[model samples]
Target chain A: MKKLINDVDAILGESLAGFARAHGDLVSLSQAPLFVRRRAVTPAGQVALISGGGSGHEPLHAGFVGRGMLHAACPGQVFTSPTPDQMLAAAEAVDSGAGVLFIVKNYEGDVMNFEMAAEMAPCATARVLTNDDVAVENSSYTTGRRGVAGTVVVEKMLGAAAETGMDLATLQALGERVNGATRSMGCALTSCTVPAAGGPTFEIGEAEMEMGVGIHGEPGRRRVALASASAIVEEMMGAILADLGAAKGEDVLLLVNGFGATPLMELYLVYDEAARRVEAAGLTVARSLVGNWCTSLDMAGCSLTVTRLDAETTGLWDAPVHTPALRWGC
Target chain B: MSNTLVLRLIEGMAGTIESHADQLTRLDQAIGDGDHGINMARGFKELAAQKAAIAALPLGEALKKAGMTLVMKVGGASGPLYGTLFIDMGKATPEAAPTLADLSVMLDAGIRGVKARGKAEVGMKTMLDVLCPVADTLRSLVDQNETDGLDERIIAAAGHALHRTTDMVAKRGRASFLGERSKGHLDPGACSSALLIGAVVGVLAPSSAR
Candidate 1:
C-alpha cells in the first residue's frame, strides 16, 4: 500500500499512465488506454501482434510490448482480462494493413473477452489461447483454472514471429505452436498483498505450501505442509514433465520464475533442482532463464515452465528479440 | 434507504473488514489458503470506487458492475463469485430502483448466482449458508418492517449465522480439503461477510448506543 502511489483507488490507472510515461521510449499507444504499441510500430504491411490481460502480471501484456513482441497490450485491472471494448481499441490502434494476431492466454475471461474482441477487431483476428501452458485444473469455483507463467514465453515467441513479417495466419499458427510446446506448473509458499488491501492475498503456514497454484492464487490443485526446496521443485517439475510426456533425450528450455516475494537465492535453488531433474530424466536443457520473470506481487512461490523445444521454439528463442523482460541478441 | 445511509453502511463494512481482515485470514489459513479477509477487503475497496459506475445504473446493474469489478480487480475464488453475484443482481433489477425489499431480492439473486457458479450450498460452510438465511430473513422482515437500516437485529442475525457456521461440517470449498480439522475454525467466508454486515449495522445504530 505504501510502496509508491498517490491514491490507492487510482493505482491501476496511474500505473498504466506511468508505464506509458516511463516506457515511452520503447512503447506508445493511442489516446485511449487500450490503444497500445511498440515505439516503432509499422502502421502498414506487417500483421500487428496484440496481447492483453489484467495489469498485475507486469512485463506481461505490457512490458512485452516493444520490438519483436506485442504491437499493442491492453492492460486490464490486476489479474483480470481486458474488456472487449479495450481490446477493440487496441486492435484498431495496432492494426497493420495485413491483420492482427492476438496471443491470448487461456484464462476464462481472457478467452471470452478475446473472442468478443476478435468478432469486433478492426483487423481480421487470429487468436491463440495458451491452454497448453498451465498444468492446473478447472475448479467448480473458477470459470477455468488460469493461464500463468507460460504466457511470457508464448508472447515472446509469437511476437518474434510477427516482427519477422510473419503473416497473421502464420503468426497465429506459430503462437499455437509455442503454446503447445510449453508446459508449466507453479507452487506457492506464501501469499502477496494487493496494493489496495495492504495485506497478503492469501496465506500459507510456515510449513505448508500450495502446488499447481494458479497465477491469481486460485486454490491450487493441492497443498502440502511444505517440504524441502528440492522436494517442491521435484513435484512441480514432475507435473510439467508428465504433462509434456517429456521422455529421455528430449531437449527443453527451462524457466524458473519466482512468485514476487521469493528472493533470487530461492529462485536459483529451484532452478538448480529443476536442472538436475531434467538432466536425470535424460532431457537436455538447451537454455535456462530463472528469476522473478513473472510474479504475483510478492507471493512467496515459484513456477517451472518447461518448453519441450523443437526447431520452432529454438529458432524463436534465438530470434533477435528485445522486450523489457527478455532482451538479448537483438 | 437513503444514499447517505447506504454510504455509511459501506463505510462501516469497509472499516470492519479493514480492521479485522487478519481474523478472517486466520480462519482461512486453517482450511483454505487464507485469503478471505484480503480478498473481501480488495473487493470492497474496488466496490467503493464503483460508486460512479453504480450512480446512474439500476440496482441490478450496479450489483453486476460491483461483482464484475470484484472479479476483474480481485483475484481468487471469492472474486468471481462475489463479482458474478453483483452482476446477476444488477441483471435482476435492470432499471428499477431497488428498495430495501429489493435489496433482499438482490441478495437472494446473488446467493443463487454464487451457488450456480460455485456449486456451493448452505451448511457446506461456504458464504451461501450464512447469506441464504440472512437474505431470506431480511426479506421476510421487510413486510414486518423489522429489517432495515442495518439494525442491531440484522447484525446479530449475521453474527449468529457466522457463529453457527462453526457447528456445520464443510461439505465443499477449500475447507473440505481439511475434512474433520475444519470444524473448529470459523468459516472464513461467512465470518468476513458477517463482519461486513455487522459493521454496517454498527454504523446504522444510534450514536448514543455506540
Candidate 2:
C-alpha cells in the first residue's frame, strides 16, 4: 500500500511528466490523449514503430521511444491497456509516409485495443504480435503464450531494421521472425500491487514461489516451494529451451530481466546461471543483456529470455541505438 | 427508450459498479489480475459525469456517446468489448422509442460486436456467458409478445448466466492464463456485466412491475 505518489489518479500523469522532463531532449509528451513521441521523428522514408501497454512496467514502451527504437509509445493506466485513440494519435504523429507498425504484446486487452487502432488508423498499418512467453500453453482453448521480456528483443532488432529503411512489410516480417525465435519464462518470489487496487495482485507465502508468472502478476504454471536460484533457472530454462527447440551450436542472445523490485545483483546471478546452462546445452551465447528491461510493478522476481540468433539478427542487435532505457554503440 | 431512461441506466450502472467494485476485484484476484473493479468503476464514473450531456442527445446518439466514453476511459479488454456492445446497440437502435423487438435486435448487434472484438463466444467464461443468454431471453420474450415483467425476466436470466461461469473454464483474457485453475471462480467480467444489467433493468422496468 505504501508508494511515493501524490495521488492514485495522478500517478500515471505525474510519472509521465517527470519522464518527459527528464528525457525531454530525446522525446516529447502529448497529454490530451497521452502518448510519447521521439523528439526527432523518423525520416520521411522510414517506417515508424509504435508499441504500448498498461503502465507500471516502466522504461518499457515509453523508455524505448527514441532514436533507432520505437517512434512512439502509448501508456495506459497501471496494468491496463491503452485506448485505441492513443495509438491512432501516436500513428498520426510519427507516421512518415512509410506507414506504421504496431508492436503489440499478446495480452487480450493489448491485442484488442491495438486491433481497433489499426482498423481506424489513417495510414498504412501492420502488426507484429509478440507471444514469446513460453510459460503458458498455446492452444485454441487458451489465450496462448504472453509476450514478456522477449518483447524488448523484438523491439530493438526491429527498430534497427526500421532505421535501415526497411519497408513496412519487411520490418513486420523481421519482427515476426525474431519473435518466433524467442522464448521466455519467469517465476515470482512475491506479488505486485496495482496502485488503484490498493493491494497485492496475489499473495505468496515466504517459502513459496509462482512459476511461469506473467508481467502483470497473473497466475503462472503453479505455486511451489521456493527453490535456489540454480534450481529456479533450471526449471525456467527447461521450459524455454524445450519450447524453443534450440539446437547444438546455434547462436543465441540471453537476457536476464528483473521484475521491478528485484536487484541487479540477483539478476546478474541469474544471468550467470542462465549463461552456464545455455553453454551446457550446446548453444553459443553470441550476445547477452542483463537488466530490468521489462518488469511487473515492484514484484520480486526475474525472467530469462533466449533468442535464437543468426547473422542478420545479430547484426541488427549490434546496430547503434539510443533510448532512455536501452543504449549501445550510439 | 427515452433519453431520461438512458440517463438513469447510466447513473444506476455507475452506482452499482462503485458499490460492487471490491467484489469484482476480489473475483479477478483469484483467476486474473486484480483490476477489473477499479477499471470498470473508473469508466462508469466518467460516463456518469457526462450522463446529462449524453442523454440530451437522441436515444441512439446517447448510447453511442456513452459507449465511446467507456472506450476512452476504460483501458482493458472490458472497455472495448463493452464499448462495442453499447456502440453497436446504438448503431442498431433508432432515434425513436424502440419496441421490444427493436431492443432485441439492438442487443443482438451489441453481442455480435463483442464477439467479433474479443474473438470470443458464449460458454467461454466471459461477459458473453451472461450477455448471450440475456440476449436470447430478450429475443424469446419478443417472439412471445411477452412484455409483462420483462425486466424481471431479464434480470433472472442474467443472474443464472453469471452463476454458470463459476464452473466454466475461461478461454479468453487474463483468466485464460490460469488454464484449469481458472475454473471454480466467477468470471469478474461476467459478474460486472450482470450487475450492470440488473441495475439498468431495475431502474428501466415499468413502475407497475415493482
DockQ of each: 0.07, 0.77
TM-score of each: 0.64, 0.95
Error of 2 at B167 (Å): 2.1
Error of 2 at A323 (Å): 0.5
Error of 2 at A286 (Å): 0.8
lDDT of 2: 0.91
lDDT of 1 at B188: 87
Backbone clashes in model 2, listed as residue pairs: none
Q: Please estimate how well model 1 matches the true structure, expressed as its whole-model Cα lDDT.
A: 0.72
Where does candidate 2 stray beyond 4 Å?
B208-210
**Which pairs clash (backbone N, Cα, C closer than 3 Å) in model 1?**
A261-A298, B60-B89, B60-B90, B61-B90, B63-B86, B64-B86, B64-B87, B67-B83
lDDT of 1 by residue, B74-176 (tens): 4555666666666776766735456777777767787788877666678788887677878867877887887445465566678788888887777666566
